[model samples]
Target: IQAFATLFQYGTFDRFPNLKFVVLESQAGWLGYLLDRMDAVFKGPMGATTDMKELPSTYFRRQCWISADPDERALANIIDYVGADRFFWASDYPHPDHTGDYIEALAELVAPLPSDTRHKILCGNVAGVYGLG
Candidate 1:
C-alpha cells in the first residue's frame, strides 16, 4: 500500500493527459490529507526529485477524479481544495457500498453547488473525461 501510494504520488498520467481519472469506491476524506502529505514530501529531501513543473497535488488536481458515497461534507471539503472539476458522481449501483438510488444521491450531493458545477459532477465532466461526448 505504501509503495503504491508513493507511486501514485510520483507518477504522471502522461498517457492520458486529457483524461480524467475517477477513483470509484474510495472515500473522499483522505484526499486532502494525502495531497498535503504528497506536496510536503515532494518539497522535502526524502521525496523524489523530478522534472515535473508543478506540485504533486497540482498533477492530481488536474488529472484525477473521485467518487464519494454520499459523504457530501467530506467530498465538499475536498472539492474546496481541488475544485469541483475534479470530482464526479457514481451510483455504484447493485454494489452494497453505495446508496441504491445513485442519481438521487448525486443530486443531493451536488445540491449546494452551482448549476455548472452540478452539471460537471453529474454528466458534463464525465463525458469530457471519458471522451463520451
Candidate 2:
C-alpha cells in the first residue's frame, strides 16, 4: 500500500504517463481500502491543494494493475471495488507456497464469477495489459 501511496503522492504517474505499474505478490484485499483512503485524504483539507491532473484513484485506474493469488478469497470483492480490469490472476508458479496445479486453482477461484469477468481475470485482462494478444 505504501508503494502505491508513494506513486500517487510523488506524482509518479504524472511524470510517466505511459508507464504501467504492476503490483505483484501482494494480495489484492488491501487495494480497495488503500484507494478509498487516498481519495479521502486527497479530498480532505490537507490534500485539497494537491496539484495533479487527476485524483489519486483516477491515476491508479489509468496506470496500475495488481496481481492476486489464485486462492485469495477476497478477489471478487476486490474486483468489484477496484474495477475488474485492474486485476491479474497470479498462479505464483515455482514458489513453495504456490498451488500444486495452476489450472485447478484458477478454476476454483474464478468459478463463482460471471463468465465474462471470469474470462477477463483468467485470460483477457492480463493479455490486454501485457499486449499478449
Best by TM-score: 2
Candidate 2 pairs with clashing backbones: none
Could you tell me the TM-score of candidate 1?
A: 0.79
Clashes of each: 0, 0
List model 1 lDDT by residue over 17-58, tens digit each. 665566777667788888888788778875556544567787
TM-score of each model, in listed order? 0.79, 0.90
Q: Please state the error at residue 64 of candidate 1 in Å.
A: 1.7
Candidate that scores best on lDDT: 2
* Model 1: residues with Cα > 4 Å off, grouped in runs: 1-4, 14-20, 48-53
Query: What residue pairs are clashing in model 1?
Result: none
| Residue 5 lDDT (model 1) | 54
lDDT score of model 2? 0.84
Which digits, one per residue and each the tens of the lDDT, describe model 2 over residues 1-133?
6766888887789989999998998888888888888888888785756555577889988999988897798888888887888888888888888858888888889988899888888789889988999
Off by over 4 Å in 2: 48-51
